[model samples]
Target: MPMAADIFDRARAASRDLEGVTRPAWSSEDQAAADILLGAAQEHGLTTRMDAIGNTYARLAGRDETAPGILSGSHLDSVARGGNFDGLAGAVAAVTALAAIRRAGMVPGCNLTAMGTRCEESVWFGIAYVGARLAVGNMDRAEFDALVRLDSGRSIADHMTDQGLAVDDIWRADGPEIKPANTKAFLELHIEQGPLLMEQDAPLGIATAVRGNLRYGDGVCYGAYQHSAATPRRLRQDTVLAVTELLQRLEALWHEIEDGVDPSAVFTIGKLFTDPANHALTKVPGECHFSLNFGSTEQRSQDRFAAAIAAMTEEIGRRRRVRFVLGDPVGSSPTPLDPGLRAGLLASAQSLAIPATEFATVGHDASIFARAGIPAAVLLVRNDDGSHNPHEKMDLGDFEQGVQVLAATMLDLAAE
Candidate 1:
């Protein structure tokens, strides 16, 4: 059986030509990455198949074929120019661990499936967990119609058609669904994607929950345009000023929430820009655009965020005499990890003497499963340089430790 390092090496080599591990949803590069996983599964003598939505699964049958299976793996899709280990590491870990079990000639009590999901990154279609939702039959036509590619302005249905997927079956729920009835539990092995593990000098961590996030993708601020030299500072409705003040107010709100309400609450302004065609160096800007991303483990914190933003917008609009429009924020609520799976992972780590901590600030496909009432857990490998960057660093030793724990946990679960 190939070790975890070998599995990661093969994945990196296969995707080397793709832009910094970018394999966007329904893109050919994404298919190529999936093909690598398929080939590896086939080589290991596991039964491989692709679903209508393009999710591939490699199954190692258990003593009882009718029993619900343990599903493990993460997305194969990546954000443009993203790091290699962000989503791919989990899939590789699943494959490696399954192969190790096979090599040991240990037959699990229940079916074990290694999956490679598609389109977990929301950057492609403005919707997260597309593949996982589809696999579990959580996607509806209305939600499917709402998914439009940010770059091409094309519907998700178009992308599926382009990829030769059976869109009708996907939409009408014409096939088998990976629900709790047939899925005993879901597990993912992913990189920490932050510096917490490195700071604590640990190689692994077990996630406690996935943070709920609100994203305002098309927030806009409007003000009347005027000559920069002619408009008085107080009289002019400057959009730049309005936006700056709004941001400051939001930052203040962040402090208030975190310090007093919920320390886990976090917020960021990822994108802000003005239309180049409508403005000049001398003209006071008429409009500006920005994005707001805030997340918290507590649902009540999200409610407070909405109230604060509305109050701030009303105040700023009145004082500055400008219109403030925020796009409809779309997001998911926080999902806690399954206690049994989390405890199993912790025990496995402890038995191996691998130091680990608890994390709850990131989102993953595992969260989608958790929200659907399926038992789910995430094991994070310590990584440096953070994630979603070309320079992201994940040490081989750290990755191996995570894989070890994942394998042991799966074995223990299967025996139960």
Candidate 2:
């Protein structure tokens, strides 16, 4: 456990930004964190390799080399100025567990690989699970080329090239490098990004499902600018008011869904702003830009929310005399974790006398694997301050407990 703590500290220092850690996908900071993990794996006598998309893997050879392997770990990238344990904790826990297994001199029936995935944070490319998607062949070549890094405004391919990855080889591959046929199961251990675990007073959680989302990143409302003082309320076309009305309607819809349909439904407007260059205190605002996100654990809920958004936007736009241009929506269907795998994780925790609970989780790379027909599970460690911020607070003891459960589950599956 000291080794785990040491690796966490080193990763935090390596990726340290202004206040928290920042490891953009395929950036030097991300590579540095991977190096630290791979170094630990090597030190413990494990073999290491990198895929075309820069997903780092440290493998402990099994008794049967040809059999499907058990894959563990999580992404190494972080949101800008985000907490250290959001993604990195999972990777560390994996390598540390493997190290502990090796130190015990126990070789299982199949390989145990600790993976460090790249670009899991959507803040970088406005998409999640880029590395996992490429590894699993879920992403098309065109989608790969179309994605641009938000901050640098460069293509994902450009960023991969800068990191010395084989972009052409990745695009030319017939299938994903990590396939369901060859992978026994995938497990990811990440800190709970919300206050649920803390509120439950539990040190760990076994995920039931990953919430699917509908997101609009470039939604806009346009209206003609007018004199604020002279324009009458009925004559002026106000975009700000129109957007707020849409948001209010969306919130009301969410409340309805939460109360009557799906209790897991949630909505947020993370970003909203008026055009600063053209707007004035005396002039009526002409344009508004915003981001809208809706999530639910049920596909029917997602469909209902999407339908409501279309209807509400039309009515609000017509009444306010503004045009609403909601750019292409992006999202995925809700992914349910493998019931057998979930049971195994829960049994492991129970056997270890670790009091834990099961709950739904936000999106993670585990969803990618599950959708690819590879059984997957997620172990959530408690974090008090939540995630994607500077104040994440995951106790080392809780992390060790999670790792203990992860190692036990891997061992059980590998023996089979």
Candidate 3:
């Protein structure tokens, strides 16, 4: 029997490998992370390969390779200042889960794929979930060509080339090689990253659905800059002020997302910056596109929220007289828990004698595969306060409880 300490030790070791390996955006770090996961998989006797866009696939051959497989893992990339555990934690857990089952002489029901996806953070192209998107055949060349990083002017295609992936290879992710039949279900075990489970005092939360989201960049705003002594506040058109107005309007619209919406319908104004620290610089950046997160179980409710939010952005931009170029709203097809799978997990939780609750996810790798029509479910480990800041931490007790819950769920799934 592997103690909790043993599991944590292995995960902690893997976490160390990914520490400070910040977003390569398009640099070698992305490739490096992929290499690391491939190596890890190889050690476990798992067959592995890297796709054109850096999405790594590792196979755990079951009694039957012809049977549809279940896949799970997190993105290998991180956001700027991303912690070592954010994405890496789930990756370690997936592989660890398989390793533990095998070492325990537990039999697996089907082929399993422990996937480590690339470009989860949009550091290179400002597009989140690139690895999952590529796996699902959502990323196209035209969109890839136009995407750019916040600080760097390099295009996404350029970054792919730098990572040893040709632009055409990225665009042409359409062959039978990248098809979706390999996955029967996608299960991702992740840190709650929020206080919901912990604050609610729930040992484990069954992820019911993932939040739908949209992201687009607005071109830089232009405005006159003048000395405080020379420029009248009333006469000057302030880019930041205009952007502020738009942001506030977005907040107002979000609040209107209906009465029965999920608690996670959040709209965040995450990043904002301006160039030319000098007082003389005019042409202030007008870009103020933030992400829209709509996480709910009901499709109609999500639809209402999206329509209302889109209208809100339009009206606010028009009022401010700033050109608002809207990009494709990353419409997410809602993924629900399989009733039979949920029942199996519920029974597993009962047998393990651990407390369990059901919750919806506003963010997750599980949702991507689930949206792609794979029956998917997420098992969450609790965190305190849900603050993603450096001060963020999780309860050791809850983490242990999570392992039991997860193990029980796995046993139940396999039994079926």
Candidate 4:
């Protein structure tokens, strides 16, 4: 293959390295992975550090340490067997973007920090957004204590105790240092996950906006179970049947979430379980809790879409009898971007003769920064898929093009 066509070359080691690192539930190979990357970063002459949650950061300081660094990173941990690129791409791309600039001897107005964030996939527990959430102070003790892991049947605090970290540490976000770090704007470039660019035949599209996301829905009904022959449909208080009906209703609402009303929206039943599930033990009705995500919209469309979802919430409660509950409206955010930063990226892509477009799909680590009132936007790349799958692959040719685009964009952004 032509060398420039091999876009993912900078990421080949880190991307492939994911397969060798086995961080199965509750067992972290993250320390080892973080250590390896930390060393790689230091050797590259980047300053490095770790967070309480183990978010590994590498810094390329500009002339001013006084200036808050421009931040670019992605979460490192993956959902069990998750493909390599979902989070890895952003980290590698950010580092490579800096490296490319270094190769061409570009200087900058402020320092740059490339982070490989952790605990994003809930691998060891249902600790989604562990790195960014803590960084942003969205996570706290009461919240952590209240969380339950469906697979493990234990409180997140129980998981924390088992892992040797104090649950109370989650509240440390209010401290002085935490706020400064959190103050920096963050940018993350991720795989589109949907077939947009590949189908559109474009090199990239600037994220004009990202939809905020949240989840809540639990179903549990315990009556009794009987052999299919013995159980009378009307006479039996079939808990299993109840849950089944709920699922069908929820799914219909979900379809409506995506098509019936909010066709530009997204919803997913990401995790779920029904207890009394052991086939060998007892035939009892099970309890199930599942997560839901409503996402996707352009900047101009987010409010109308959110309003529609809010209306659906009332209907969901009315339809489900099994103590249905929705989470406190969380992860809500408006469109945010560094106008100066974004303008440079957009104009640079056009000047470079690279294909570019402007749009936004859903929220990400970048959104976390935008919410914190920082300038940020996502940059899309080709040759990526199945963000958390083990067999995931990245197209090297597309990766190279991403590098060039990123390199050019950064050079322009840092231009005085």
Candidate 5:
């Protein structure tokens, strides 16, 4: 079996571009990444193929072909300008684990399928878990048609056309579906994305749940535009200040709730912009827009946050003399990871003498599988910086340890 560092190095080499890991779903870079995984799978004597929605799977055949296969791996697509380890690490570990199992000459009782999923980041489109949803036959036609990529303005179907898949074939009821019944279990290894594991001085951690989120993808605050020189400070309805006030109040509210209720609750403003095409330096800004992302593991906490936002919006509108129009929230609810799988993962870590902690994650593909009733586990390797950025750093030593835990867990579960 190859060293875990070598596997990561190979993955980085495959996606080494000017823009950090620029393998958005359905892009040439994404296809190349898939091909790289496929090559690795075939080299290990595993049959490989891609499904309609571009989920690449490599299977090590078992004695009982009729038995549900053990599925392991993660998405290969990355957010634009994202770090190489975000989604690619898990897929590499999956193949590496399978290769190690093969090298041990242990033929499993059921098939071990390594997968590299697509569009899990939702950076290109507004939808998350696209590839996994399609694989599990949970995607709807309307939802697929409505998913428009921000950069290309093309629907997911348009991208599917480019990939040579019929739009109608994205979701299936009969064959080719990868659901809980057909898959015995799912396991993924990912970078911690945050400093939790590193701060705790641990090399690996297991996720307890993935936090649910409320998102205003296109939120805006409106006020009348006026000449900056002519308008008095008190009389002018500045949209920038209007938005800022609400954001400030919201942050305060977040702290209050987090301190008093759930400490894990969090919120963020992802994008803030003012129309530059029509604005001038001399003019008071008329409109301001920003994305709102709030999340927590508890449903009631999210409910409270939404209520706070609504109340704050009304107050901001009345005080600033501006209108607050928030876009509809879109996101999945918090999903609990499988306890059985969690225990197994913990046992593997302990047996290997690796210190591990369990925490709630913001979002991840493993959560989707867990929500769909498939037992799932997420192994987080300690990293120096958060994911989805160019400067993201993950320790190669920590990743190797994570791979060891994953491989041990797979062997334990696959043993007859």
Candidate 6:
């Protein structure tokens, strides 16, 4: 097998959880994965370093040390029980590409750095791109310190302290370690979270934009519990029905917008359940808990979707005599990738004769970089199963193709 495959196998072995891999942000498993990447970088004669927030970097020096360099790679942390390849594949491919360039005796004009960022998965800290945001000086230190891990109920600051990181210095530092001033471009090689590439029978894809999302993790519908048989349809406040109707209407609005406004618009109700302890199935459900996520590449579409959700919930709640409380929403704006960089990646794909396409991608670390004013691009490899689960499948060959494109793009940017 290739070096990338070996690294992937080793990472999975070290971080294997009950059904999938679990490399929680700033946890031992997360560090272990970074260590593996660092070791591999060292083996390939690259210098390695870890930032204040535990983001790892492996540098392959170029001819001009002072010139702005090209940064690549992806996050190391995974959602709880997530598949191994979701984020790790990109980091591994980055290191492998740098190694390949070194072996081929190719020297660009600027440095190439493979970055393994932490806490890209929001499941842990409920905040996406923690490491990447900090790297670009976009994070608010106060907000970061206040964030609590979902499972541990511990603040992110406590987690960082426990991991032996200098929590205070992180905020006191002059600026971020990786900034737009020093970085020419950020290229991320990641697996397609959806089945787009696989369905297209293409091995790779270049992202055009990253979708921004509105996420409500704590959405609740409340009503008075009543006897199922005794309560008439007009009298009973059915929380379940109210919530279901809200979602159905929202989905319908999404379809409308997708057809006319933005074809990339998507809506999902990821979680919905009635209170199990309150009553049995015989009783009218009194409460429902759910999560709502709406995403689109256009800000206007997102705004329209948000308005529709609010209107629907208010109308349904008033009619059903229920109450809807959607917790504070959190999300980023849609980020367009660098068109020139994307075109260069496509040119490289064409030159290499790799079947590649261009499409919008879900949020990734590359989005953070692009938002920070650094040119960014995302190269996606084909994956069989969707991401954030154990079934994610990226063929080794497909990953190599992504790496080839990434390396070519990095070289193109570095030489300039």
Top candidate by lDDT: 2
Model 5: colliding residue pairs: none
Each model's backbone clash number: 0, 0, 5, 10, 0, 0
| Model 2, CA-based lDDT | 0.91
* Model 6 worst lDDT window (10 residues): 167-176
User: CA shift at 382, candidate 6, in angstroms?
Assistant: 0.8
**What ranges in model 1 sit over 4 Å off?**
1-3, 141-176, 223-242, 272-289
Give lDDT tens digits, candidate 2, residues 132-211: 99999989888888999999999999999999988988856367788887899999999998888889999999999999
- Over the full model, what C-alpha lDDT does candidate 4 score relative to the true structure? 0.58
- State each model's CA lDDT, in order: 0.85, 0.91, 0.62, 0.58, 0.83, 0.89
Instruction: Please give the RMSD of candidate 2 to the true structure.
Output: 3.0
Model 5 regions more than 4 Å off? 1-11, 62-64, 146-149, 152-158, 161-170, 173-176, 222-245, 271-291, 315-322
Best by TM-score: 6
**lDDT: the better of candidates 2 and 5:** 2
Per-residue CA lDDT of model 3 for 1-416, tens digit only, reads: 23333434443444333333354455666566566666766776778887777777877667666767777778666665455556665665566556666667766777766777777775556667877776777666676667876677877767777788755665552452334576676767777777687677776777766755554433344454545456565655455766677667666656765344555466665556555454344443434333444455666666776676567556654555555445566555556666666666567677877777877775676666666667777777776645333444556566556555555565455545
TM-score of 2: 0.88
Better of 1 and 5 by lDDT: 1
* Candidate 5 structure quality by residue, lDDT tens digits, 328-386: 88866777788888899999999999999998876778887777778988888888768
Please list the Cα RMSD from the true structure of every candidate, rounded to 1 decimal place: 3.2, 3.0, 6.1, 6.7, 3.5, 2.7
The Cα error of candidate 4 at residue 122, in Å, is: 3.9
* Residue-pair clash count for candidate 2: 0
Q: How accurate is candidate 6 locally (lDDT)?
A: 0.89
Question: Can you tell me which runs of candidate 6 are displaced by over 4 Å?
Answer: 152-158, 161-164, 222-241, 274-289, 317-322
* Per-model TM against the reference: 0.87, 0.88, 0.70, 0.68, 0.85, 0.90
| Model 1 TM-score (2 dp) | 0.87
Ranking by TM-score: 6, 2, 1, 5, 3, 4
Candidate 2 least-lDDT 10 residues: 171-180
What is the Cα-based TM-score of model 4?
0.68
